[model samples]
Target: MKFNFLAKEKNTVVNYENAVAFPLTPDYELYAAVVTTSLNASFYEKDTTRLERIKDLIQKSNPVFVAKLAVYARNEMHMRSVPLVLIVELAKIYSGDSLISKMITQVIQRADEITELLAYYQMANERNGVKKLNRLSKQIQKGLANSFNKFDEYQFAKYNRDGAVKLKDALFLVHLKAKDEAQQVLFNKIVNDALQTPYTWETELSKVGQLKYYNEAEKQKAFTQKWEELIDSNKIGYMALLRNLRNIVEANVSRYHISKVCDYLSNEKAVANSKQLPFRFLAAYRELKELNSKYVPMILDALEEAVMASAQNIKGFDVSTSVVIACDVSGSMQKNISPKSKIMLYDIGLMLGMLLQSRCKDVVSGMFGDRWKIINMPKRAILSNVNEYYKREGEVGYSTNGYLVLEDLIKRNEIVDKVMLFTDVQMWNSNMTKDSFAYSWNRYKAIAPNAKLYLFDLAGYGQTPINVEKNDVYLIAGWSDKVFDVLNALDDKNSALNYINRIEL
Candidate 1:
């Protein structure tokens, strides 16, 4: 049997290539590190110690920069793959080839405010629309307007060359007691070094976003080119983790013209939704994975990451609360997923209990078929038994009567703090179908007025029914961590907070 997707036959390389084992060595790190320091303008100001070290790191070809940069950028963007082609191209960002410098200076700064140019390029490629691409190209190149301080930026652009100095230092060396003329010479240098490459891809990217322009023949050629670039007989897996990550990411987009940079992807939202997702690739996975069915744990983890990264103000939330979770285990649940989804869900449910336990003391979880299970124990025990619980539950059918079942729990005059119900819509009532919405609403009110209702929808496929999207239901949309982050933040908010938002006269 084959292992994972490894490059097949090896290719011949000359003496220089022999030392190189993988597609890209650690040397790529130099440029990759730029993702972080890219906007640390102070680094670019003058020949500081840090700047010199970076130059040396790049000149010698170290990989740390790229590897760390990739990891950091992924966390920040919640993205996976970046196009290898664009990564290779980033090496050109400061090629000191005056022409390339003049062309790319604008795009680099934009990386701070916008995502890298490659994401737009990817959409353009996939969509095969030239107009949108042309628009993006112009937008990128337009940033160059800020570089008019010819002498200063010219000096910055060429700062790598010898005899570089700040304006004050340069004035002394040039023997120009007059600072103005010295500045003039510096300005002239910048204008003289400007690149000749004209901005022309605005239309190209626009075409990409729309995706309908490329002819059938051209599309085939583009597909073939992309596929060819990714495979190699060499199986060193030098950057295996990184490579797998990009593969997972780029697969989100179906179109080649709309290039989702293997490393940096640009999307419209601060956070992307899994169901009714914006990007084609994410939505495709949502369908392929039947995401709504079994993505709660993943979402929770993402939420944890996001919460952890956010302002510590989160620490002040009324986390002393607790909840009881009931997850459905109907016969329909026997539906296997991605080879390991069932087991994955079991594992996730166990892990989620732990995360919840960390924040609150009262937490109980159960998997119910015709019967209900009580998973109230320490984190480790639950994890150990979750896999077995799934095995025992294999091939079982489940029934759910949301109202009667939850009502059976002991009632308190005070509302329960939280109620977490995880179920696919497999057993929602039929006779009261029209009132299902009302039933769901009443269940929340009766079971736990003060408690928050969080339904981790696990059966959403193709698309969730419009009605299911009502409040309290969160659909996990992306595989990245962001989904969980949003959920946790949402869940962590106390009902009292919302009550505070509403003040009646």
Candidate 2:
């Protein structure tokens, strides 16, 4: 009496899309969840549920793997909050040794993260009511205490803001001993709130904001001058420059300063050191485009160059390898990555899709919702190509009918070497037919046996649209440009878990 037909596949699950798919292994799921999240609620999953899911995954995963994943997410992916969350959640379950402390030291790159880690620690442990710090995780405290040695007076003063757990509270909780007489003096200043105000972009902008202006024209003049000063001083960091480009342009800064800004924007070394995701340049470009300022073209050109710099390391296919890149433009994909962010999930898809398309010598790129349509595109102008796609997204209906891509390929009897789908992975059949992505992929495999499917999981909902293990499929997650490195690794027959495992703890 064999009942094997009724049994589901060993690693399969019904996803949020209500499609039969493979669940990521504990380590894979953890990596995907950490890299793709900012701890905000997604269209398909709430922040609380995602938090619980991560906690459960961390408990299921090995402690050392979790630690390395945190470092990888922070150092490689440039993620901020979730790495701290991973460490905090890991602390609650694993109490072996200096692993947690070492992780905190590795992940906390900025002075503010010290307080952020403490705040998250307080919230995660439900210790808000009990203010005594004696029961706090000693390893975390040791890590924070050691981290104190890395900052100076300006770094500490810049982040000493009042919160549920302030910097002063963290200093007290960690019981950090001063490293030297000078360090002891700095500690006193931190405790007494006597640290000097660090010169920064915010302070500079505030000074300009306070100047009395008699009229709109006068205010614009003042702002323009201030922006020029900020640009000349080099006090504004790269991220600050990107975020305030619109303000700088609207203020009508001089051509000298604008050119200076463009130079900084396009500098390969600066862009690399910024560690910003490629979509950030796209976001900045979109904002400037809406203004229709004369400088828009200049900034757009700079952004195009900047994005290419960010994607310089992406390993794409040559002419010998035919490629098709399909981006998901479903209604769900239109949801914002964060509540206040103008950038949506689909933006990441189009950005990454265009980036891949730029590298491929022979490629077919398009968007898919209820149907898949191929759009011929040039290899250059990566950001502008993304813009073109964003403007025409409505041409396709709003539904997560991703299987239509493979079905289209099968209908055309195409022998594409690589098929890339940049999507949220909540793919389902819009018409409720028996045909699914898995079915179409299987049929296409018969004709193109060497074909590979790469799913760029932007939303990281923790499910593949198809069973990755049973097919020639690779699941890559994260909104960072480093995610492309996973593609090259996969080409070498390596999995994402293997990529994370190779990270040195």
Candidate 3:
């Protein structure tokens, strides 16, 4: 028998599209909101709206669960900003014990996050205009003070530059007793602005950028050499390398360095260690592809290998289990995920949909908008398939007609073990009848009794496109490849909240 978990009936809420949908429980809502955020505006919601919704959810959800989610998002999911936001928001109302301080130690993984947390604390507590931070949250101050021990003088100096809340400001705000005489001296340096400048990727690049060249070709040559030097010195990080592939290509870096890049990118261990969201590879691929450089093919091959490496742990089923992956290429999905990003929500859907397709042995994948048309795809060429879908998304007009996927399957009397919909989950039916996604799902389930539906929520608008509580349906939220791990837990009769609850604080 399939794993079945039950919960109290969830109330309905009208989504941004004015469609009837099921509202997620507070913990589920918080997970969705936290994981899918880049702390920026999505298609239908502004940044402030998203922040307010998260704050309100934190106010109502269990404090322990909220703390665990913050740690999970930071350490496991490899998110930076949202986890800090979770800690800050949680601190505004929760101080029953050392939970806030412990959460800070767990969530603030990097030195820069120390300042970031304080900045957020300042903003959230409305202490921006105040001359002194005497009224800062004591729990937060304790957390920040403990956090200072995790970094060294050079690490602290790197991010101590100008910002809303400087590292020095944080030093004064949290009067941490130094762990040792050396640490005390480092703290003194932090306050006196006398820390030595550490040689880093940023510092090296800044030095190169200060040089003046005689002509455009000379300037290009200088940059090309600098990039090669950085690569040779191993100063460029995995993520930095991914984001700068286009720069490397444009600067006409040597083929030898390009080979090193491809080698590093394709290394499975490096890919896993980077903890980059799958969309980052897609963004790099898309940008590099537009350059029309000969190295595009080499870099694209490396990226394809990297993304597939990242997908190695995605759960799969036997050939007997039939699956269909449907992606939403609706109009709203065309909007970029962030203000300065070229990656769109639909791109994420396509990348993840295509990645899942690569893992499944027996699967039919296609995109849905005004209509759902099945497209045969190769299992190995994940990024290529996503590009194919991106090029042809316009073929089906943009109307969010997700029901058509099921409606077509029902008409054909096809029985699939699983139907996965990668979408923003703002699904609406203009023909609002039994043909809606929910109604169509009910009809389809009746024909195929063991069928289950999974919604891969890309935008996390806090509402399901269909009722998820009663049906054998599941919702997985996030832009990371790690989100797919939830599938195995779900098959073991675990809910998302259960998954978060299992996180040991």
Model 2 lDDT on a 0 to 1 scale: 0.86
- What's the CA error at residue 362 for candidate 2, in Å? 1.4
lDDT (10s digit) by residue, model 2, range 158-277: 888887777788889899888789999998998888999988878877987888889988888887887888899987889999999999998888888889999999999999899998
Decreasing TM-score order of the candidates: 2, 3, 1
Q: Residue 498 error for model 3, in Å?
A: 1.1
Top candidate (TM-score): 2
**Residue clash pairs of candidate 2:** none
Report the CA-based lDDT of candidate 3 relative to the real structure: 0.86
Summarize candidate 3's per-residue lDDT along 19-68 as a digit string, tens digits.
77888888889999988888898888899999999999999899999999
The lDDT of each candidate is 0.35, 0.86, 0.86
lDDT of 1 by residue, 219-269 (tens): 655434443344322221222312233332333323332232221222222
Q: For candidate 1, what is the lDDT?
A: 0.35
Runs of candidate 2 exceeding 4 Å displacement: 1-3, 9-11, 129-132, 213-218
The window of 10 residues in a row where model 2 has the poorest summed lDDT is: 1-10
